[model samples]
Target: MTTDALIPHATGRADDPQVRRRAARVAGIGYLAIFVLAIFANFVVRGSLVHPGDAVATAADVAASESLFRAGLAAFVVVFLVDVPIAWALYVLFRPAGRDRSLLAAWFRIVYTLMLGVAAVFMFLGLQLVTGGPGSGTMGPEAGMLMFEAFDYAWLVGLVAFGVHLVLLGRLITASGLAPTWLGWALVVAGVAYGLDTMAVTLLPDYAAIADVMLLVVALPSVVAELSFTAWLLVTGWRRPRVAAETA
Candidate 1:
């Protein structure tokens, strides 16, 4: 009897190489959406709307640009929504490497998403606090500033979970031999950067003094890691040929 006849294949249909390739491509697109929308919302819109340590000014800025503030909130909502499928797609694409580890990574990302979603409520509340509507007069500029700061700190907390996900994902990708080893190393670096930055912000008394320098140090590796991985998924889908796995 042939070995094929004697030993049945254990892989499921979702485990098919073609399916994984398609999933990888979708995940890549999702990553691009996340990167672009997050940058726009967090940096561009928030930067324009907020003035550090000046609650009255920040509130005035947001109130003056109400439509823009709403748009930024919407962008964050979209990011939270996209994150759900990205988690599942990544789990599907990487599960072949180590199912348990992949699942753990996915859960970490999901937790981060949930935390961000909760944080977004603070953004919406900030809008209400700054708007010229009922209850707006009751709350002062300080209240609005507190809401915005809550949103920022909440996101920073979420980053901790996100960092864990990246570390697990980086390890998986490096071991899989399906992606460039350099990309995996970059991801590890990014993960470490995230953790360190979070610690600085949360635990350090001199966080403000060093914040800009820390951001500069963390930015490059994190951007390169994510963008490179994203481009690889979009362009190559997967490095390994489907035939090899199919025949095996």
Candidate 2:
């Protein structure tokens, strides 16, 4: 990284229209790809396989669909690969609003992404058990479930950081006045929902009983705000809005 890149410069460096536009485009595309792949891996692939409290079933599912499980893991790898560039793109896109805040937001997301990488490693552990690989004798269905749970909880912890990133991202959007203010607010609300849901899941032993409702609470806002923000990046972020408020 260049020295100029290391030190957070003032807003003027990022105020260039073309630069912001390019950053927006890059982030938009990367975000779209990661979102789609993640959803597919979690819902279509793992979702179908993993039973909340049933270890034998989960292990059997993974074994029956070993190839799909591998594909799902590959999908995660793709998301992580795309995540680094998205972090940099987001930083560039928002630094004009507030350099310090943008830098912090990017760091939060990078940290979260690394946590996701850890979750993927756990998924690999589960795969090893299913394939009769090393440690298979020592590991069984119960242990496989434990690995999967580890993946989920690790990723859940990561979401807290991701939530913070989203909140800061929302503030940047609103501060810059580069996109619709409502969208920014939506992002903020979504961030809070993410944190709250994570907290509940962590603290409440019977969270599963109300998982559906909480999922709605988090998923509704998350989908709406993030997808809308992605849409904005694609359609409107690069260009200056009719009224933009820049910080000094």
Candidate 3:
């Protein structure tokens, strides 16, 4: 490109509008895919009730019947992996050029996504070991519980990291003059909920069930918010990153 074309404008750098539009479209679709996977995860975990009166022999039975749980979880991992690139694309679309990115905001997203993978790894391992197949009798009920506990532990830590990531991302959106304050706040709130819900399992051993129920409640709202935000982005694209002057 010529020097004149490469020159920075008042908005910092003149990026291609079409590129930004495409990135926004991709991000919107990625978010929708992740959300659907999350719903699938819920379906997988909601297994049939094994009443105390029933002659249930092993945890393997429970695992076997609810294999959808494993499948859903695996699907989640794949969708999340796909989400990373879409997220990066969105960040690139809106991020300021000609600015020092020594402390790049994308780092937070990468860290959060990495933690998600870690949590998934632990959970997948636990699922694999717990699911009764050929070598099911090797591990007792207590052992099965231990595997679950370990997975929960890893997930708890990951949630904390993930929450921090969301907070940082929300802050970045607010500061970047891209997207609405409402969407930014929603992102931060969802992230905080992720951490808080996991806190029950991490710190308060007795409150695990309560935490799960709380998560279910908060998740509905978050999913709705994300869907709404994605729809908005797909329809209108970003409406000129919110700026103080625009508000004024």
Across residues 1-248, which tens digit of lDDT does each residue of candidate 1 receive?
A: 45333222335454677667766766887899999999999898998898879998998999889988899999999999999878887887888888899999999999999989988999898888877556677887888888899999898889889988999899998999767888888898898898899888988987999988999878988998999989987776545676786897
Better of 1 and 3 by TM-score: 1
TM-score of each: 0.89, 0.90, 0.70
lDDT of 2 at 116: 92
Clashing pairs in 2: 21-238
Residue 97 in candidate 2, Cα distance off native in Å = 0.6
RMSD for each model, in Å, please? 6.6, 5.1, 7.3
Each candidate: what lDDT?
0.84, 0.86, 0.59
Over the stretch 1-248, how does candidate 2's per-residue lDDT look in tens digits?
Answer: 45444323234467766667767777888889998999989999999988878988888899999999999999998998889888988898788788899999999999899999999999999888766778789778888888899999999999999999999989888888877999999999999998999999999999989999999999999999999989988884445654564531
Per-residue lDDT tens digits for candidate 3, residues 1-248, read 45324222234333656556555666676777877775666344523312222323325555666566667667768765965765565565555442233134456566667766776765555555556544556764555555555645665676666666566666666676566777777877877787787776657767745856886856865676567668866764444544644897
Model 3, poorest ten-residue lDDT window? 46-55
lDDT of 1: 0.84
- In order, how many clashes per candidate? 0, 1, 1
Q: Which regions of candidate 1 are displaced past 4 Å?
A: 1-15, 238-248
